[model samples]
Target chain A: MSHRDPLTPFLSVDAARVRRNVERVQAAADARGVALRPHVKTHKVPQLARLQVEAGEVGITVATLGEAETFVAAGLDDVLVAYPVLLDEAGLRRAAALAERARLVVGVDAVEGVRRAAPLAGRVAISIEVDSGHHRTGVAPGEAGAVAAAAADAGIEVAGVFTFPGHSYAPGAGPDAAAAELAALDAAADAARARGVEVPVRSGGSTPSLAASLAAPRVPDELRPGVYLFGDAQQWELGRTGPDDVALTCVASVVSTVGGRVVLDAGSKALGADRAAYATGFGRLLDHPDARIVQLSEHHAVVELGDAPLPRVGERLRVVPNHVCAAVNLADELWIDGEPVPVAARGRNA
Target chain B: MSHRDPLTPFLSVDAARVRRNVERVQAAADARGVALRPHVKTHKVPQLARLQVEAGEVGITVATLGEAETFVAAGLDDVLVAYPVLLDEAGLRRAAALAERARLVVGVDAVEGVRRAAPLAGRVAISIEVDSGHHRTGVAPGEAGAVAAAAADAGIEVAGVFTFPGHSYAPGAGPDAAAAELAALDAAADAARARGVEVPVRSGGSTPSLAASLAAPRVPDELRPGVYLFGDAQQWELGRTGPDDVALTCVASVVSTVGGRVVLDAGSKALGADRAAYATGFGRLLDHPDARIVQLSEHHAVVELGDAPLPRVGERLRVVPNHVCAAVNLADELWIDGEPVPVAARGRNA
Candidate 1:
């Protein structure tokens, strides 16, 4: 150890803990005959992405073209951008560059989107994003085949389908949501098959729903979960994972103790203001789970400890954010087991 | 410009607008006979900090040692950390390093804090943080003298006092709350003077309170406002600034538009989820202010244009985040005008 305090408000990813999560999720997928294609958005570290590949993941799923580029630059051969990507001239150029390095896959939902991506038809593969009840993006599951057919008509190779089971993060919804997600993927796959298109890869899974959903019979061909590697307050509240499963935490120092409240140095800037609908507090205190973050600002988090005593001014405590993905995006680097490690692919937001 | 679709989730700082705000706030401080030391936490961009310094400001204020280190590395001299920092060995060491480049000033509230900072007493200057009715951090106004006296006894040079008029950020409470902040700062100054302390600097002012408190004569010797440089949704809601005054905006692409709603490529990952207490929606759409951000997932923002029509998919829009500071913290680089510039001090979370 350098004997120096690691960055105060940065996420510390325990490499060993992250490896355990990868194995746990990989085993779950293997047990159900599904391929695990872990989402690279959570860690956004190319090292972790490589570790997933080393751990026998099917491939990698990214949330942005920037992420795909980062992974491709790190020698990853196959990557899927699960977002509804609009291929403007710049996107097409990036896709062209990415095609040279890896088998780049882009997701689209509309006919215009297919037409927009026509320029990259031969350069990159396309996936139709299906809306499996999350209602955020993607075409309806029944309409997935139509979009896929349009992409095929545009000389683009349709590489199966994908959906984000975002609602699975809600409390009491993971298993059912995952089951619904799988069913929707099946429906989309059936639609594609009806058109004589072979749907090779079916992807969907969030951290909260990964275990429950990936365990179902007839699991999809691939799972793209991002937050499982960093179990946050939402995962803890939903009982998807135990406190010990969390691999990443925000270390903050006590900055204030006034009026029975202890304030932390890390606030929205560090922990992010991503409050899970199921979570009560802003974040869970690793050292004191009973404490509640009653108030948060850009630079200060006012913690209200009920029966539990708060930490002293000089004390440092680890904080598990309510939403791991947002928390990871807030930080520039990660402390690997309390050691600051640069997130090489961080800020690659395209 | 690289013509890469503006990097889907990058923040763009409008130089013209930010310069206008800098001049406006500087004039407000000058009218009140207070030195402007705008807090650099909101933008975290060294260029903006330098702009403020050039705008006849006394110094810059930061909330973290990481921020101080970043500014110091950028050749900024006088910097005050507004938060009551805990002086761990790491903090003391970083402070010592910063003291070599800049006049690092830290906030102290208690005797233990003073003692903790005793190691770096000869290296850095100290500022007693006084509570101005926010009930967050800092000691009582009357206790400022005691803390300053303790720091002075511990061989630390006291540089007067500072307080965050956080309550002034509350909507509709600007003038009265700013009055309260001035009164608290005045009381602390009086206490310091009575205790035989010089009490040269009395720092106070927030974005919402700046127009009111900073314009009031004899409010304080120094003014520190962070969010004004990058006016956010909170500033718009608090009636502190107009849309034209907003300098920073998260420029995101419309990834998907289905069912009369548009899904933005930027989610909490880009805009951040720091919804101010009175934020009307998840964020403010510069082009479509009426568009309600119905939901925000990890990597997607769902904007529901119920009765109002929204832009089509692939259309780019500027989004004013609820809190600019938190949003800046999430991003690693910024698109100024049309160029992607590294926010050199972006990830200094320590």
Candidate 2:
């Protein structure tokens, strides 16, 4: 208690673990003869993206225009926004400016989305999104041709076709999701070719489905695996990553301990309350495997001491969030090797 | 598409509505013969807290040391941190420094918590917390005297007791939770008094149980109701707040609209993915009453078009988040009166 623990409940990233994770995934992508375009949405840091670039990554995928701007501002030359952006006039202007500085490709799920970005025709390219079992976004595989044709007509280059295998998040669902991704990408490319559009690039990947995506009958030309950078409780429970692969943890202080109840300062605000149906608790303690975080208020996490000794008040614990992306989104900075690194693109969800 | 909607997804707050809500709650507290010490956890803005002060609030309540530091740095004088802070030497030094500038009261539930803050015994006072059915934090009512005696022996002034009736959030549990809160406060105070401690200040509140906390057999000396400043969908659905009372909204654009499927740019990151067992959707559209958000990804929300007409791509809609606190915590600034006001205390979760 005399010595400070840098500030309780901050995000602590293991630099060595992150570097190993990057090398491991990059090597896998290289062996598959596919270009690794790591998604910066997982760790929104420019320095981490540089590590990916050094590992031979072709480009980076982002979820929002803000992320694209953040990386490009940090001197990255290529970015792919893998979400259909229905831009207003201001956004179009920002996209136009960003496209001038970097090679930018925006995802489009419908002809309407393609027409909306018509103003940035020559400056930016459009990638038609196809539904590959995720069903959260993207149009049907057969509908990709119409959107691709629409982008061509709007004077925007039909850069490629892509899909997000979101369903691969469940346990034992990766291989099937990867197969669906490949089949959808192939069908989408064929449809675009039928419409007199040249589909050269095929992009697909999610953390859980990355390995299977490469080993499928037809590997995609590019992959966008985000959560692989720092495995979370979901990936651990789903058997997507080994024990040593989780590179980040929320360092929290035990604020209250009475009988079986152990409370931590990292609550829903720190660890995030995005629980999977298969997850056993709200979050997992990295050091104590048996302890279960049963509940979360804004500033408190109630831990059920399962076979683990009850920690004294003021003791610190390393917590791995249910979803790392959600947890990182809440913090303003990251603590890497005891030094604070700004989450440069934090609160840039738009 | 031609006219810009500021930004696709951003937090928008109605200043007039927030003012009315402040006056309304302050009036209620006044009539109940209690000093309003509004919790700043909901809307972490000093200006809103200033509105409460102008409405006759005696002091302000916060949940964390970071929040207390934020409000105090913003020129707030009297601050009460309503959570037990297990401080290290650095935090103790900070608390001591803060106590010198402001009349600070920190909550203590365990004897260890009192000992940890004993360095600021003369400058800072300690408030004993009692468990009032929220089982989240606090000790039992009978245990208050032991903690109070420890604080009294540590040369710290005892600031009486407090309880948060979090169970009042359920549909019909307001009255019962309020009754439990009042009873716990009385019992905890009596126990402290028996230990030769002057138990003068009794604090109890939560937005849902504010009215019942006043009308119960006994009224608390102070009320610390948060979330009443900005009504959310949970408050609306639970019958705690009127439709017109909601002051904040997240303005989002329809990113994709194809046949029966419509997607908005506001996803779990913008609106947050905290869903109670009783909540119907991730959030509710203010303009469309029947639409339900079926799923939320990082930057995309899938909407089920229920009797409402499909909003075209680029169309903007005002959305009321399920929980206002979680939503506000995600944004960098608030668009109030068509101007940007920085959420200065954003990411002060430590």
Q: How many residue pairs clash in each candidate?
A: 0, 0
- In order, what DockQ does each candidate have? 0.60, 0.58
How would you encode candidate 2's per-residue C-alpha lDDT over A1-350 as one tens digit per residue? Answer: 32224688899999899888989888888888898899998889999899889888998999999999999999998999999876677778779989888999999898878878898888899898889887777989999989888887888898899999999888889999999998999999999999999898999999999878877767999999988889998888888876578899999998887545788999887877697878898988888777778988999999886888778888888998989999999998898877788898887877
Q: What are the Cα lDDT values of the candidates?
A: 0.80, 0.86
Error of 2 at A112 (Å): 1.9
lDDT of 1: 0.80
The worst-scoring run of ten residues by lDDT in candidate 1 chain B lies at: B1-10
The CA root-mean-square deviation of candidate 1, after full C-alpha superposition on the true structure, stands at 2.4
Error of 2 at A181 (Å): 1.4
Cα lDDT tens digits, model 1, A191-295, are 877776778888888777887775676677788887787788888888887888889888887777755578887777777787765678888887677777877
**lDDT (tens digit, per residue) of candidate 2 on B284-329:** 8777777778788888888886888777788788888888889988
C-alpha positional error of residue B300 in candidate 1 after TM-score superposition, expressed in Å:
2.1
Off by over 4 Å in 1: A1-5, A215-217, A258-260, B1-5, B119-123, B215-218, B305-310
